[model samples]
Target chain A: MIVGDRKPMDEILEMLEPYENILILGCGTCVTVCLSGGEREAAILAGQLRIWGKKEGKNLNIMEHTIQRQCEKEWVDEMRGHVEKADVVLSLACGVGVQLVAEMYEEKAIYPGLNTTFMGYPVVHGTWLENCRGCGNCVLAHTGGVCPITRCAKSLLNGPCGGSQDGKCEISKDTECAWQVIYERLKKKDQLDWMNSYQPPRDWSTAGDGGPRKSVKIEEVID
Target chain B: MEADEATSTSEVPEEFRPRIVAYCCNYCAYAAADLAGSMRLSYPPDVKVIRLPCSGKVEISYLLKALEEGADGVMVAGCMEGDCHFMEGNFRAKRKVRHAKRLLEEIGFDSQRLEMFNLSSAMAGRFAEIILEMTERIKKLGPTPLRKGVKD
Candidate 1:
């Protein structure tokens, strides 16, 4: 899932200074799973803001609402009433959700409340680790299930670089060497020969660096 | 309830009396408070106790909302370490309190205004002492920065 973190309160307060009626919009999908921008998070932000407003003696009326998925137009439409009532919206969704809302509400001021971090999942109860680069390609079939593109500090294709030492990445002792894990997995499966297949330089076009990426379900689209 | 309005009708002196919200876990701290009451022990009246099933159940929103509603200080009192009736409820509350403290600091509020305490149901004297400690600390800190001048 897409992981995100809430922006600093000082930044949020500064952006909200000019607005009176503010709506804290939360996404119920990715951000929710990451424990950053869910309905509870929306209420938490609203509570903080209300305290700030009262302290500053500002007449700020804060409202909070969350939708199933902010990137979907149907879910975004459900917030039309709330969007119309607020002078500004602080969207606690990923960059995609923020843009979709901005595109739909051209006349309203839409702001991002979270910094979209990466495609990842919680590695522990409260810890999340990025494991995908969204390269628009799947290399897991060749390498073990480990993603060297994200886990490796250098994103090495044929890793266990000189920096890897004792199963730990050179960058941080806390980070396990991705190649080491991959080597072990492949060795266990007797597929160590796969590592000999040197992968060529990646084509950048498929990655986000080329441009905005999209997918169209030809059969599902009508018109 | 409006704490300020509720206090306005009291006969207490006009000095700055900080309003404090104390979240007491029913399994321990609440019972300790009851024991304190039965023993005729005296503590500051400024501290209002809100009983919860477990301190673990205290959400970060509850602590922030208390401050938002004009609480000068907030504290969560639960069972001592390894003594929680719900196994790890007090432990969870301790972590939540720490998290709430960080959030409070981020908002530019004094994190000292919030605290967590560990107690057993038999610690009646300690319960009163905790209230006095919090009340004195809040009094020294004066009203919450959020409640300094806003007329609710």
Candidate 2:
């Protein structure tokens, strides 16, 4: 899932200084799963903001709302009434959700409450690790399912670099060399021959190189 | 004027008593509190214990809510490391406690007001000690300024 972390409270408070009626909007999808932006988080932030405002002698009218998915137009539309009531909208969603909300409400001011980190999964209860870069290419078939693009420090396509030492990457002892993992897995599967083949340079066009990427299904469009 | 001055000199300042909310795991800290009671151990009466099924169930929102609702201090008491009945609930709770403490500090409150304690159900004496320690620390810090009508 797309992972994100809430922006620092100081920055959020500063952005909210000029606004009195604030709407803290939360997303119910990926941001919620990552425990960054959810209904509970929205409420907590609202409460904290109120306390801070009271301390500063600034009276604030804060409202909390969480929609199904902010990235989708339908979900963004559902929050129109709340947006109208708010002087400013503090979006506690991923970057995509924040942008979508901004696009949907061009006349209203919107501020992101979270820093969208990466596409990753939680390794443990509260720890998340980045596992994919979304390069718009799948190279796992040739590398024994290990992502060299993200896991490797150099994004090596062929084999291990000189920095790989005893299965560990030079970046840190905690990080395993992606090539070493691929080599070991391929060796176990008796498919070591795949390692002998050389891979060409990766294409950048499909990976949002030229501009923002979009996907559309012509048949599914109602119009 | 002499009589008025004498009466004013005799007046004593009211002691500051902190209101603390402790979220205790039922398997460990809650049971320890009960044990402390059964053993007749003395601790501060300022702490109000709210028992939960596990320490991991203590959410950050709950901690913040306690402070927002007039709690001067908050604590999460869980089992010792690696001894949780739910395997890693205590560990998870510890991380959440640390995060919540940071949040509290950012919100202009004393981070020391929130703490995490690890103890076993059998350690009744230790439970009493922890309560006293927390109370003394809070006394030194004085009442929370976030409390309504409190002066800095």
Best model per DockQ:
1
Model 2 regions more than 4 Å off: B1-13, B32-43, B80-83, B119-129, B149-152
For residues A169-202, could you state the per-residue lDDT of candidate 2 as single tens digits? 9999999999999999999988899999999998
Q: What's model 1's TM-score?
A: 0.92
For model 1, report the TM-score of its A chain: 0.97
Poorest 10 consecutive residues by lDDT, candidate 2 chain B = B1-10
lDDT score for candidate 1 against the true structure:
0.89
List TM-scores for all candidates, in order. 0.92, 0.85
Candidate 2's error at B120, in angstroms? 4.4
> In model 1, what lDDT does residue A168 have?
95
> Any idea what lDDT model 2 has?
0.87
Worst 10 residues of 2 chain A by lDDT: A50-59
Task: List model 1 lDDT by residue over B49-81, tens digit each.
Answer: 999999999999999999988888999999999
